[model samples]
Structure formats: C-alpha cells, structure tokens
Target: MTDVIIVGAGPVGLLLAGDLAQTGVDVTLLERRDGAISNLSRAFGVHARSLEQLDARGLADPLLPTGSAVGRLRLFQTVEVDLGALPSRFPYLLITPQYNVERLLLERARAAGVAIVHNAEVNGVDQDADGVTVHTTGGSHRAAYVVGTDGHRSAVRQALGLPFPGRSVLKSIMLADVKVAEEPAELLAVNGVGDAFAFMAPFGDGYYRIFAWDRDNPVPDDQPLELDELRQVVTRALGSDYGMHDPRWLSRFHSDERQAPEYRVGRVFLAGDAAHVHSPAGGQGMNTGLQDAANLSWKLAAVLRGAPDALLDTYQAERHPVGRSVLRSSGAIIRAAMIESAVGQALRGFAVRRALSVPKIRARITGQLSGIGYTYPAHRGEHALVGTRAADVALAGGERLYEALRDRRFVLIGDADLPGWEDRVRVAAPAEAGGPLILVRPDGYVGWAGRDGTGLPEALTRLAGAPSAHMAGHTAS
Candidate 1:
C-alpha cells in the first residue's frame, strides 16, 4: 500500500504529490487524462500565496520562466489595483496558465520519485480504520490516505456520500484564447457592458485570453463556439471592431458556489474544487486549492512520520474556514460584476473608485487579492504567536523567516540560550538582529513566538516535536 494516493493531476494535486515525495513518502498520483493539455487556459492567475508555497518546495524558479509577473490587476471601469501593495515576499501575481503550472509540478513530482498513473480514473473508494482502498479503472490500489483533488464533479466525493451544498449562479460565461494583433496595453481591462462583461488579459505571447458573458443567453451545451459570436461579444463590450482571428480554443462554463460539508471523511480527504467550487470572480479558485494542498501535505507527512494524530485534524479546522471565506468573497465579486440594474452598476462603480482612493481600504482589497489575510487559530495553551503565519522578519543568519523555512522543518530562532528540544527542530542564532525564541513549523508557519520562550514547550508539542522528557510540561528558554 502506498502512503498516499492523490486523485487528479491538476496543479494542487501535483503540488501535494511533489511535497510528499520530496519528504520520502511513497505517493502515487492518478490522473484520468492521458497527458497534459497546453491549449486550455482554465485558470490564468497564480496569486502570491501560491508562489510562496511553490518557493518552499524549490519549484518556483524552474516554473517562473513559463509565466510573467503581473503587478496590476484591474476591475471593471476601475483603477488598476497594484498587487505589489500586498504584504508578501512575492508581491505580484504570476500570470501562468493552469496547465503549465500543473506540468511543472508534475515534473517536480517525477523527479522526487513519485509514481504517476495517468489515465487511471478512480471509480470508487473504501476507507476503514486501517487504510483506504481506491478502485481505479486500471486496477485497485491501497493507500494509508487518499486525497481527492478532482474537480467539482468529484467521483470520490460522490462515493463517500458527502453533501455538496450550494446553488449555481445561473450565469454563463465564455472564454477564448486567441492571438491578438493589438499592441500590449499597460493594464489588462475588465469592462462591464450593461448586462454583460468582458475581460482581456495579454499572455505576453502576442496572444490574449478573453472572457465574456451573456446575461440573457442560456448555458450552451457541447455546441461548437463560432468566431462570429466571440467577435460580436468583444465588439459589444469594448466598442471596437478590431481584427479578431486565429482562435486556439473556446469554451463555455457556468459558475457554481458549492462546497463539501467537510473536507475530511475519516482517512479520505477532499481538496481543491472537490472540496469547494465557486465563481472565479477574483481568480481565487486555484490559489485556494494550492493552499489546501500545502496545508494538508505537511500534516500528512508529520502524521505518517510518527507525529501526533491531532495534526491531521487541523487540516479541516484550518482550511474549511478558508474555503468558506473564498465562497462568500467570490459570491460578492460575482454580484458586483453581474448586477444588471443601472443603480446597482452605478453604486458598484462608485464603491470601486472610493475603495481605491483610501489606503486602508485599498490595502484590504489587495490583501484579499494576494491571499495574505489567511491565518489559522492558535491552539489551546499555545503562544499567542503560535498557529499564525510567520511574517517575513530579518534574522541573524542574513535570511528571512520564509527563506529559512525552505528547509521544511520546525526552526527555532533565538539568542545563544536555546530551549531544550529534539533534533527535529533546528536552531539558528544570529550575531545581529536579537529577537525572541521563535518556532516555525515545517509549512513555514510560526508555532511559537515569544520573548522568554513562554510557550515553547506547548508549541513544540503541538507541532509534533518531542520536548524534554526529563523536564515537566513548563515554559522553557
């Protein structure tokens, strides 16, 4: 039996597999598709948080070449919002197609000795106290744990009888990736046209991905998209009759705001679109999914490697709230973009302009855009700083908290006097920049941060590290 079997070879699934394999877990990833497709631009924006997660695995540099950095994102009839204003080491969004992101992750997973079974669609799954048995079209495989990163129509979720509770937005949107002869503009634009809206983003390849919606039209079936329909939508929205041709791909999709009742069901877990699917209004879907994988990967690794089982429970505790927040935020974005009434449009336009003018309001919006506002609740008796994401603080090692965390271990940073802890925790003392003893989790979150090491023992215990066996449970420095 494998340690973990991840269904779906999307970016999130591949990212989880890569992390697990890098940490010496025997993982198998099953993808229904035979190979990756490059033409489809399912998702176009990778937020800063996902970039941070990718950097932790040393995969960002290699994948950086496939996309460009986008610092400004514009809303309909509003000023461009600067992504750099977002508080993150990666202060910009990476504009890479979702397929390319998946491809790079898959390559990293393979290099880490992960086994991949393409075209192996999972039909059913059975989980007990021992493990999970996954039945795929190719064959049956057993795993200590199984993660479903499949899309909204997840077969694993269906088999487990999980309730996917939500309703559709009832709006049909169309997307097309085509070569545009128009010159590159300073800012990509999303224009609101009375009842419809259109967004145009340049891919830096003399091509652009355009998304347009028809508020009155019903959802289209497998009917092939016509070039005239695309051109007409662009003309109506942009008020320009530019030369539009050379269509690479066209697709129609509807938005659903559904979310699973629980992300975890015993040994089987749901992630990405399987756990929650919502309108891609703010381009938060893929970013949320990547974060889910990042959160779950380390916890699974720790549990398999003899950490406390409680670590696994934190997966749902942390990510379920995150998913709910995304659903609500995206729903608001959709409402703002699709309001057909003239009064509603005027109000939304005014609000957008007013929000941009205020620094605090702008920063709050940028935080949502950059995905930096996420933080888990501190566990009981843990340090106030524990269970929070470590800010990028300068250290004596001439590195930052995020840079030091690249080692993917709980890091204890302090002065010469260090707490007595096991070797699983790494200690670093700086010649300069005196700070409190800080314990960082493997996933780059702060497990403990205090001046006198007030909660180091409890933090270490919560992080699955063995504290001193001789000393009783007490704060130590």
Candidate 2:
C-alpha cells in the first residue's frame, strides 16, 4: 500500500506528489490520459506569490529563464495594474504557457521518485478508518490518504457525492495558439470594447495565444473555429488581428464559478479545480490551485509522520477563505470586462483608472492580485506574525531565509540552540541582525515567535505535533 494516492497529474497533483515524495512519503500519482503532455496552454501568468512558493523549493530558477516578465497588466483599453511596484523579488508577471510550469513540476516529481501511472482512470473511491481504497480502471489501490486534483469534471468528487454548486458565468470563450506577424508592444496586452473582448500573450516562443470573446456571437462549443471569425473578433476588439495565421490549435469553452462545500471527506481530500473553479479573469485559476497544493502538502506530510489528525483540518480552514475571495475578485473582473453598453464600459474604465491612480488603492490591488496579501487565521492567542508568511529575509552568514527551507524541515531562527528539537528542528543563529526567536513552519509560515523561549515547547508540540519519544523529557533551551 502506498502512503498517499493522488488523482490527476496536473500542476497541483505534481507539486503535492513531489513535496511528499521528497520527504520519504510513498506517493502514487494517477492520470487518466496517456503519458504525452499537450503543448497548448490555457494559463500564462505566473504571479509573484506563486513564484515565491516555487522559489522555496529551488524550482523557480529554471522557470524564470523561460518566460518574459510583464510589469503591467492591462485590464481594459486604458486601465492597467502595475505589478513592477510590488514588494517582492518577482514583482512582474511571468508570461509562460501552462505546459512550462507543468513540465518543470513533472520533472521534479520524477526526480523525487514519485510513482506515476498513466492512462489510469479513477472510477470510484471508498474509505474506512484504516485507509482509502481507490477504484481505477486498471485495478484497486489502497492508501492511508487520498487527494483529488482532477479537473472541474472530477470523477473522485463525483464518487464522493459532493455537489459542485455554481453557475456558468460566460459561454463560447474562444482560444487559439498561432504565429503572428506583428507582436504587441507590451509583454501582456488586453483590450475590450462594446461587445467584444480580447487579450494576447507570447509563449516565449514565436507563437502567441489569442483569447477572444464576442458577446454577440453566441455559438455552441462544437462550432468549428474559423481563422477569419477569430480575426473578425480581434478586429472588433483591438482594431487589428496583428496578422494572425497558421493556427496551431483552437478551441471554444465556457467559464463557471463553482466551489465544493467541503474540501475533505474522511480520508479523501480535494484540491485544484476539483475543489473550486473560478473565472480566468484575473488569471488566478491555476495559481490558486497551486498554492492549495503547497499549503496542504506539508500538513499531510506531518500527519503521516506523527502529527495529530486535527492538524489536517487547518488545510480547509486556511484555504477556503482564499478560494472564496478569488471567486469574487475574478468574477468582478470578468463582469467588468464583459459589460456591453457603451455607458457601462466607459464607467468601468473610468472607475478603474481613477481607483488605481491612488497610491494606497493601487498597492492593495497589486498585493491582492500578486498573492502576497493573503494570510491565514492566527493560531489561538498567538503573536501577529503567527500564521503569517515569513518574509524571505537575509541572514548574517550569506544564507538567505528561503534557502534554509529547501530541506523541508522547520527551522528555529535565533541565537540560542535548543538541543531537544535538534532532531526535528534546525536551530540556527542570525548573523548580525538580532530579533526575536522565530519558529518557521515547513511551509514558510511563522508558527511561533517571542523574545525568549517562553511557550516555545508547547507551540512546537501544538503546531508540529509532539517530537520523538527520546526528546520528550529534555527541556527546551
């Protein structure tokens, strides 16, 4: 039996598998499709917060080199959100295809020795107190835990009999990847007018992706996409098609804003589109799912090692609010961009430009879109820093803060050494800078902080679960 069975091999599943396997958990990844990976991508924007998560695992180095950085995000013809001014190492959006991100994660997963099975469709799942048994086309597999990272039409979710309650927001949204003669001046370009809306972004290759929608053209998903029709919509929105030709791929799909009521069902849990899906307006769909994987992976690992089952509840507690917020924010963006009346369009543009012109409003919008503004509910009676992301601060001896987190272990950053936690936690002293002793969780969040080691032992036991039996008697420094 495997330690965990993860359904779907998308970015979320791959990241979770890689993280778990890296720490010696036996992870089995199941995919319905064959081994081949599609070249086309539906997502292109890699925001700052997602970059920070990737950077923590040392995977951002190769990905950053493959994508172009765009400092500005044009929401409408005249309204833009400036990402260059955000307070992060990766202040700009990286315009790379979804395949690029998946490829890197798949590579990491394979490197970490994750067992991957292709062309295996999961039909159903049943769980008891001992473990979960996943029913797939090939055979049955048992595991202590299971996660559903499948897409919107999730078989795992269906087997669990959970309702994905939501409505379709937009229909007949067209997408295509092709070569263009004249590229836009900005790295990321978007424009909307009257009844049509369109956006374009390069795939770091000669090919560019065209996302066009015409509210007046209500066609079925099966309607064949003609190059002329695509050009017509582009012209209606942007005045020109930039000489689009040689379509490599084209498809039409709809958007929906749906979320599962519960993220966990006994030993089975859900993440990514399986749990929630929102409009692609803010390009938050894939990023939100990836962060979910990051937040849940460490907790699952801890539970498998020895943590109490209650620790697992925090995953849903922390991520459900973020999911709701994304749904609202992204839905608003799509609604604003889809306004049909001339008066409504003018009002949206004016309101957006006027609101973003202020320094505080601009900063808040930037932070929200970039993913740095999100914070989990604080632990009971804890410091302000608790449950907040630990900023990547530079230490004294040429060691960066995130670099210390690559080992996937909690680090106690301070001057004093705690021998009792030597096996579970690494005690390191700050170089020149002096501050309160901080306990950073495996996921890079501050679990505890104080001037002295008061309540430090109890915090560790609560957050990280009790340490090994040998260290139980030893007192904390």
Which residue pairs overlap in candidate 2's backbone? Answer: none
Give Cα-based local distance difference scores for all models: 0.78, 0.86
**Range of the 10 consecutive residues with the lowest summed lDDT in candidate 1:** 415-424
Best by lDDT: 2
Tens-digit lDDT track for model 1 on 1-477?
A: 999999988888888898888778899988898876555656888888788777777767777788878888766665477887776778887877787788778788889898989889889999999999999999999999999998899988998999999998845578887776564354355666566777776665767788787776666645667778877877776665256679888878778999998999899999999999998777899999999998898788878876688888889999999899999888887778777777877888888888788998888777766777677888576567766766666666577666666656667777433344554566766445556677777676776787776656655665654544544444434
- TM-score, each model? 0.92, 0.96
Clashes of 2: 0
> Compared to the true structure, candidate 2 yields what TM-score?
0.96
Residue pairs with backbone atoms closer than 3 Å in model 1 (clashes): none
- Which regions of candidate 1 deviate over 4 angstroms? 415-423, 430-432, 465-477
